[model samples]
Target chain A: MPDKSLRMRRAGGDGLVTRPVMLAIAGDSAAGKTTMTRGLVEALGPDRCVSLCTDDYHRYDREERKELPFTALHPDCNHLDIMEQHLQLLATGNPVLKPVYDHATGELVRPELVEPAEFVIVEGLFPLWSKLSRACFDVTVFLDPPEEIRRGWKVARDTSKRGYTQEKVLAELERREEESAAYIRPQRQNADLVVRFAPIEGRDDPAGTSLSASLMMRPTIDHPDLTDVLQSGLSRAMHLKLERDPDGRPVETLHVHGYVPREESLGVEKAIWSALGAPDTETPECLGRLGDARSEPLAIAQLLLLYHLTDAAR
Target chain B: MPDKSLRMRRAGGDGLVTRPVMLAIAGDSAAGKTTMTRGLVEALGPDRCVSLCTDDYHRYDREERKELPFTALHPDCNHLDIMEQHLQLLATGNPVLKPVYDHATGELVRPELVEPAEFVIVEGLFPLWSKLSRACFDVTVFLDPPEEIRRGWKVARDTSKRGYTQEKVLAELERREEESAAYIRPQRQNADLVVRFAPIEGRDDPAGTSLSASLMMRPTIDHPDLTDVLQSGLSRAMHLKLERDPDGRPVETLHVHGYVPREESLGVEKAIWSALGAPDTETPECLGRLGDARSEPLAIAQLLLLYHLTDAAR
Candidate 1:
């Protein structure tokens, strides 16, 4: 009801909700922020779901950032105030002149105008790091993949795409680890859903098995009913359990096995499609793709975020 | 490769295998067999998936069956040998003239011709009752919902659909309990997967919460990797544990909690879909519905069977 009330305040006076519902997906670099948002944008349709990166708020370009004492992960290295202002504008369904940060060139390009669509997904390191930034979105998510895995992903991505050597990437990761611990990780506490994709702790699965995923579902928002999909008694690839978070709060944790066959993951996908009111006639084909490869965990996580984005609009 | 060999044997020597993969869904009356199979048919497409009820093998009409000393569940009351032969015929992609027992009119109608499609799902009390029948399927599933829930579902269905009063249904249930225990229940042991749908043992969820389900993944056949789903930290609605069955064999039991939101179930479903090779463009819309009411457990059970049916074809 309160959520509806908030929606009312943000709507146009003509009794139609022209305001775009906002979602914030925040995480550290190489923490799967972009990968997560990519599927969401595809699933929701790029025309309807406007996506942006909060890293664009960087006051200093990559070259300039090197002179700073703090790493990019630190609050001092970024323009939190400007990011928050842009979020507020987007939340009210207003357009903003958003800056761009090119990862490949490490350059801050000229600002470009962006109009709010039916839904807006903002992904970056500090989207939920401040109260003002957090309040601008109806739903928030944080990626918390294991540090080692993140490091590996970061190294591989940077060396291949960003023109960095593996050694440079690893060293940069080590340098940024401290700031990440202080600034990026804490944002997870504010998220409605904390997603972690990692390998299972004990199993020595034969080669070609994908990593498993664990999501901490905090009661910050109403989620889709997953009991049916998990309990369908037909799949062994997924499960859910009520557990306690680090803050001692009771939360539900959903674990999705990646090594399972693709059909098992599709079961959960259909459940989501129905929960999302069967948004399209079919599940978005663009989902589950990471570069040329496919990742089911990423797709499911994006679908959950998509559910919230659309559910809030309704 | 061996499975392919069997396929070759079934084909008409063209080297292009055409044998339909078989799946057996065996359960007692009102065990959610039809409800479960309905989704598979829809998900796989009616053109590709053929479904048959082995109960149609009843030697006598329902009215005449009432006069017999043995219940319909008893081996003597049905043409189980004929059913076994038919199963073998279907398994090898052959056609069969199958008997039809019309539940609506309580009569033995004319036999119908059945040609196996890409997939065949056989549901009834005795489909897996005999070893010969069990060997006819590439995969087998047993529905073992709680007696109380089954009784409630049966009463609701028989009174509303069949020409039976609640009292008569109850009496019939009591009369058939012995036969169900002796003849129907034992068939569960022969199944590769045992699905039990029921409420959580302790909690009293308010109305509208669906029933939970527990699936016993027996090691009779290799299952897709589900560890990724069980280990994914996102959901609390589902869980997996290695436990001992009544026969003392170690099995993996997956429990899906019904109280979690639909989102949690979607996570698990996507994991399964990924495991199943992301069959189709979407999750089957026909799954999880039972007489206008949707049951997540039923949908999931159906999805799992669909996985087997499709997986065998691959």
Candidate 2:
């Protein structure tokens, strides 16, 4: 909420964070992480944020992997220790030569230089699996959509975008389910926040195809003022749906309908702010944050969390 | 032979023996293939002889080979198809980017350009083993030295030239022996000539260690005149040590002892050449077929034989 360095200076001691703030976006293949990430990144602009993918850590290319006993999804199939070391280097405000994975030929080609920025988002399925690498991240979010939605998304995305046929995508999804459960799904329970973007079932308005999203923020961590998040008006047509998280844990859900009116979404955003103790200043103290115009509320929420993560470390 | 080319030209035919020749030099590791190749090349000059090594075909470095099931000596551990293709290309007067094997580090550092010349000396352990490749060589020689001599040479070369310890050198030699036996030694039996250089086993010469050499020539097919070989003073010192080959094939063996005097070695070379018929030009009606020093006996025997082999098919 304040100049982090100045905040510490005013607090009368030099105790401050030194490492750059990092976030890990862990999700299954075709689980809406990239779509959500692209939208949020576009809204935030590029100067203050940078992104890296975990696929570059794979030791062998697709063709090479066919000869190996383990599939690419297994941790041993990647140079995880090397990846971990690179993440630590980036967290300390440096850079690394990231290996290139050519999706067209499914080969590992030349490496490219990846420079670190103030906010780093490392996105991949196994990003949170290695504890040593996880130590570099300040904010960790896991995307968990229902299996039916995930499968549908995977089929559509793989067929349309990855040069796969519908049958092949579906068959691959079925085959991967066991490994997905064994390795990927368990990571959701450990995230600082869990995000899900899907239509709330059983809701059939005359308008049809209602969609909703919820950000489950854990307590005992620094919370952000929602004044900036409300500016993008993402929750305007949505409802701040809350209920006991099945395991007796506290959880809040935002449920939006596809055909909901725009003004209603704005109203939902306002409710979210009122719920988070939106900053009381007349104009708002968040700049460089959520910005003035071009963005969405969900994006602003993501940035606000990143600010807290890096600022708290300082 | 008379000028058959002149008679053929008059009869509307060609008798210049316009075929590519194959020359193979097989030897154990560090047994002087590279050294002898350097000497032959210098003497013949670049225009007449081109030397290439099979070491360039290795698929992995030494460190990587330790993890592999087979040793580098195995054909599967090399890009043999590419090598055979390159060899065929070179035999047809084409150039190839022959890969370089850094013997010191046991790595393929880079590919070197090797253009076809008049004589192509293919030197390596398994050069003669490939049936398809043998059709390309015109002459083949195997370098044979005693086991103790080879070990001493390897120890000295690996320590001083390759930067290896005597212990490591010995261990590597032992590790490669099985693969060598299964892959390299059989090629020796296919050689046209076996040249062995070693000290006389029991003789003690007071002056110096005058090691003898034996050049076992099986020129059952067309070969350059031995008269030229005798004229050069190598024939007299070569005692005809006849023996049946291991396969029970009858053959003539020419032996030169370590204790032989220099003058006698020269005398022996002359006696063999005189016996072969180089001085047959003494008649009044017969002008010598070779009128220039360029066609000298030693040059014709060594370099021309190389030329015949490499140009046999082409």
Candidate 3:
């Protein structure tokens, strides 16, 4: 393609447009994609930000997928074309009559209308799967938590919330591994940022400590200058280092430690917020919320995303 | 407002597109819109053509409309934006997740996917109601039957098929008259072909005779050359005359007589089909069907629409 921003401006038809900035958070099931998206949406508030799950585009309900040979992770098992079309419409500041797949009932329910706002956060398995859909996003991030940790998250969430038994969740995870490898993992290479949240390897942390976050910031877009903030005596909470990406390319990676003191994390958060030149006096309190608990690593990661979204709007 | 054909070609990327031709048959309720659209879809075959009713975009079901202040004919009472968006998608040879309205139960049911074929026929109210929507059609037609004939057809159809009593139908018709004039009838000004089916005024024809058709073909698009065909001694069945259109503009009107003998109508049909340059030796037998009865005028009107559709495809 053509430059999507230019196409979007032309599609506006001479009207004044603060065209919505689109963000895609793509990952496999229970990879913390929703967790990453929810904080950003909450911080921006519902009026300015709207989020949707691409899982709603599933061609087969949970029961229907059982009859099919392939899992829902495969592109063929979902209406990816319609998802791409809806993304294009949303990116161009249009409304969509979106399909809704009810995970609880394993059935396709009545669709609802989704109106795009200033920030459209789309998270699911296939938002970044296609070039057309990927083109619609101003920034794309992929969640890549380790398989072991992701399996644990899936089992806990499914059993506690979705009413699935641990055995059934484990079996479904086992069945989905092949498709996840073939389809989901490959999308990480296309992301502007690859985020992995996990406990530090080889460092035994006390129980109840949140997982640290490692964000691999690719050179696809101009990232915020964190050198000054990192140099301002905030190294205990977060630091940046040059690392090799999965594709063997060198990238700047920011690692936020979850075991850091709350005051130190607050100092780093204030530094990043001020660097963003945001008009608000303080950072949004809604960031990094995991139910009732707050995760410092998630808060910093969401702050980084907020910087990119606001920068693109400019 | 930009060139839609060019946009559609660009949207197709490198893929070769025999882009589906679009035809719009817009009219008030019981004004023969479905009858006109059905014949064209049948003649083209399901594999080559698909049809959808815009009334499916109704924002309220029959039961819900009773609680509203205005009738369903109002633009606010329908998702015209979504309808327009779907039309744009279809015109570009894309599939739409279309909403379905259950007219019998007066309920909004689950939506279905609609894939465009070689020909896409869109009928019902509001297809020609907006400039953006009207732009998506290759050929636009408005059914303009006389008020008396339309009311009679609505009463007959609603009572026999839709389970509406004659008194209820008449009361609803009376209530809808203002909106029909305000929202529905005004679309006639936008259609390329204004078609009216009724008995010729001041002529005493048998009660069982088919209603004659008066087709006012505007100069908006290139019409088929019928000079040679009309001059070939087929005047007994149909004749072309210069007439002033509703807006007081000169237009070429073709009047097909319903009382014409079957042999005379067949001769006219064959001539028109040959004029269309179709390779088939005979016209489709599905044309002009009216519940086990055939109408010669209906067949000729449908043939005229077929000409426009195929011409646009070329």
Candidate 4:
């Protein structure tokens, strides 16, 4: 409990060779992190990867906290130290007993045992907030979207599945904004990639029909091998380029078109796998490279990084 | 919490006519209380009946308690007084913010606001253990399925739903016997009715596919006017008889056969409704009787008794 951030950093830096890969999917409420994570988990299978949400560590059961001054989204309202410990444990391949929170009811549910896998994706707001929690991850992604887009997504999801009335959804969103700004927004600066999907820029972008994205990749890490990935799968409209953010850090940006051929994505995967020098074995497909939009490419790129780090461990 | 039982008895003896009625279904672990209660709830409709699990108030999350001497089922391992407060709140029209428990992972999940309904059913091991809780119940039931039947039900349920191995279930069952006896079994004497379902007395009477049920009813609560019910349609095999335990307390027993047709149940319902003399309007079909092989007559008897108790209070 002595400042979890300090412990996480200490645990992370001590005897670290090629640091074990850590990734975070930071997003506002329901911006598709769960959907994307589901696909990733399906592709990688749960054995090689485990995903956890930072919301589990809320400090109070919903009712008791209602009397508190601050809402649950605030830092003081969570067991940040305990969450950091579990993250560290997971990153180190040890099992951690994590707390449970019921989203629909706004209460702390039960604790669940989470065994570590090769990759752990920590998803939620403020996941990248504390230096300790951030120290535990080697790669972090932030999801950003326009207000109206996020709100629309929230409305449809909550009403149909969660029994929420329109008024409750809007009220909750309004109440959470202050905490989101103070605690969740700052975490984006620490992320390796920031993915944003919104109506396309600079045109007659129909309300919700178009999509565009921006990715911010930290320069400290080695880039993925993307030679064959670039040659196939991606339509001519899909391309990658480098740009410097306002902070002056270089970013690798991938632009994906609204409509891309499926085979091209498959071909891109094959190319990236071949670049990994593993000789295009079917074993990787079974290992879970089957669904990445650029699954083959991302699989090879991700696996190459993993192989390098694990090999360096020995 | 000024002794919840004291509060309830005050509501009764002091002539508080407006308070919502509270009913409890008490039993040992794996008893048929959940199934029976589910039937009642579904039949009554969730709006009319609100049910809370005292089991949800465990003091420790599942993993932490694994190393502790007391299991989750032990009284000392839960926050009982808090549970009493919630029950008292629920017994009124007020809402109780109750704790959430995750059944799959055996952890405390979150809390939810449980609004009081017309009839509240508190179902769990210690529902009737404390005198404070006993005072709140307008009617109490103890489901005492034979040990063998309970064990069979438990093993099947735990293995299928809880991720427990057969050996683990058996071992846990063995471990719980002492605590169950000490903390749970004594509640039977305090209950208004004890419903037992087991293999009917004859092993060779193969067509005796019905489970025998004994309703140990305490007949002193002045019975309701069942004239309307008796006149409406209660003559179908639904007959009442008086029974006595070895200890000599008068017990009103009602027996319904497994093969009793549905129409006969409607008749029993109409008679009970007529007896209440509350309203002459049609009683909805959904309000039909909850049968436990022989509970039709016993329920009619129980309702008549409840009606008179309310009238006496007024």
lDDT of 1 by residue, A1-314 (tens): 13322332343211222677888888889888888888888787778988999877776778888888988888877767557656655665556556667788888653455788988889998988776667677889998888988888998899989999999998898899888988889998999999998876664264677778887889888999999878879677778889999889999987877776688888887898799776456777888788898888777777777777778877
Instruction: Name the weakest run of 10 consecutive residues (lDDT summed) in model 4 chain A.
Output: A11-20
Off by over 4 Å in 1: A1-314, B1-17, B203-207
Model 4 agreement with the true structure over A49-168: per-residue lDDT tens digits: 778888877778778887997877788888775566456545545455567788777666555556667666678866777665665666677777777888888888888777789998
Candidate 4: fraction of native contacts reproduced? 0.17
Most accurate candidate by lDDT:
3
DockQ, each predicted model: 0.00, 0.01, 0.35, 0.07
Backbone clashes in model 3: 0
TM-score of chain B of each: 0.91, 0.75, 0.92, 0.76
Model 4 ranges with Cα > 4 A deviation: A1-21, A203-210, A227-234, A279-314, B1-314
- Residues B1-314 of candidate 3 have per-residue lDDT tens digits of 12222332355422443457889999999999888888998898899999999989988889889988788889889999899889877876779999888878777766788999999999999999876677678899999999998999999999998888999999999888899999999999999999999887655275877888898999988887777767787666677888898689889998887887778777777777776677477888888898789888888889889878878777
Best-fitting candidate, measured by TM-score? 3
Interface RMSD of each: 35.0, 36.0, 9.2, 23.2
The digit string of per-residue lDDT tens for model 2 on B1-314 reads 02222332343221122222447777888776775565456655667767889877776778888899888778888766456545654654555556677887776553445667766778886676565455455567777777678888889888998889999989978988898778876776777777666754554353554445555666544433444444454444445656777767666555666555545554543443344354442111111112231212222223433333423433
Candidate 3 lDDT over A1-314, as tens digits, reads 12322332344322443558899999999999888888898888899999999999988788778899999899999898899889877876789999888878778776788999999999999998877778788899999999999999999999998889999999999999999999999999999999999876655274878899898999999988788878777566678889898679999998887887778777778877777687477888888898888888888889889988988887
The fnat score for candidate 3 comes to: 0.24
What's the lDDT for residue B56 in model 1?
83
